[model samples]
Target: MVDGGGAIQRTTAQFEGPRERLLCLGPAALRTDELLACIMQSGNGKQSVYEISTKLLQYVGGVYALADIDVAELLSVPGIGRAKALQIAAAVELGRRIVHKPSDQRLQIRTADDAATYVMDRMRYLKKEHFVTLLLDTKHRLIGEDTSSIGSLDASIVHPREVFRFAIRRSASAILCVHNHPSGDPSPSSEDIAVTRRLEEAGRVLGIEVLDHIVIGDGRYVSLRAAGYMDN
Candidate 1:
């Protein structure tokens, strides 16, 4: 039983065993709860925040589920007081923002696969469909990314005007539409094709070229343009 003081008192023989050392190896390799406990460095007389974070992860299902959780839901977990909940929320948000932010100043989307690789790590785990637009300059460098819609498993409501609105505002020369299928199938549905066609035609008139439409699935993705849908 570790107390709320940064002190590991009363080490059981079981804990001192080689198996335990192998499991609780280093701070860098600790599980989410252990890492959180390291940050917290203490418990609240009963259990450590590490233990609480472990319980919270279990209650929420896992780390991915926890990412989808809101502040209220996170706060409801034991030992994850308001401050800790906010901290977790903030950390997740920071990670999200980092992923969305363009990394390389010279990053350019040369192909559908390139675009997919950029957003895959962020969108693949989403529980719901999210329609995002990547705005690009004439050189194909990413200027911005916008979430046009979010919806249930079947569909996400989006408007061509909404998609281009950000492009126009940012003076982007082209755009690539990307979305995630929580069902883990990257195949484009009839509705997906229709939406892409609509956006393409709209972009034609607006002088903002529709570069491609990429559908993200579980560890896989499909580019409508690369599949010959856009050219046809």
Candidate 2:
């Protein structure tokens, strides 16, 4: 896979009675999958619309990865037909248009604060944890950002190989790990510190620097490096 095969896998909270809740509680109550379910409208004979949406998300990896998949690739999934796949591809393109405007030509990550501010809005609002990487070029300019995982923070979930594989492919000189706290606290847990140390060591071996591990919370953030965990 030319995509480097490292997945992003970011998802919103799973929907519980999505369409029903959508009527009673409004769109804010719908998960990302449920919102997509609304777009898909219905599924193939076997799977329910929600199940189809979930399977499509898994096949493409996630919202971030969806932008990379063409309609042909989407048709490979069991429930996604040609028309449905194109519908999804078009929706993904529309979303990519909205949230991922082109980066400024002079984009830079000069400080951990700069890194946190770059991703905080997206991270903070997420209902689950999202482990993301800011891929930076030699001049510390932003090349791309990859979400490595989305869920609770832990070492097992944060695979160094998967994390660095894409960074290496991006020709990134350094990476900044950013993840959110759904509980609204920006403080680092012991697990957070451990993952930072582990990934920092892994980055050293791979010849790519791990600049900082930032924890995003409601309107605030933490830089492990500034807290004496790692250095810039």
For TM-score, the strongest prediction is 1
Across 1-232, the per-residue lDDT of candidate 2 in tens digits comes to 1245785432344235576567656898688789778878887888998999888778766765564466887889878888888788888778756785766585789988888877765666565677888898888988988888866433226788878989988899988889888777999998889889889889888899988888988899988988998755
> Whole-model lDDT for model 2 versus the true structure?
0.79
Off by over 4 Å in 1: 1-26, 38-48, 76-81, 97-104
- Writing each residue's lDDT as its tens digit, candidate 1 over 1-232 gives 5679876655656454333544556545456665555444456679855577678778887777655677998878877777777777887888788766755575799988889999898888887799999999999998888999988866888889889999999999999999999888999998998999999999999999999999999899999998878954
Summed backbone clashes in each candidate are 0, 0
TM-score of 2: 0.59
Clashes of 1: 0
Any idea how many clashes model 2 has?
0
RMSD of candidates 1 onward, in order: 5.9, 13.8
Would you estimate the TM-scores of all the predictions?
A: 0.79, 0.59
Task: Indicate the residue-level lDDT of 172 in model 2.
Answer: 93
The local lDDT score (0 to 100) that residue 35 gets in candidate 2 is 77
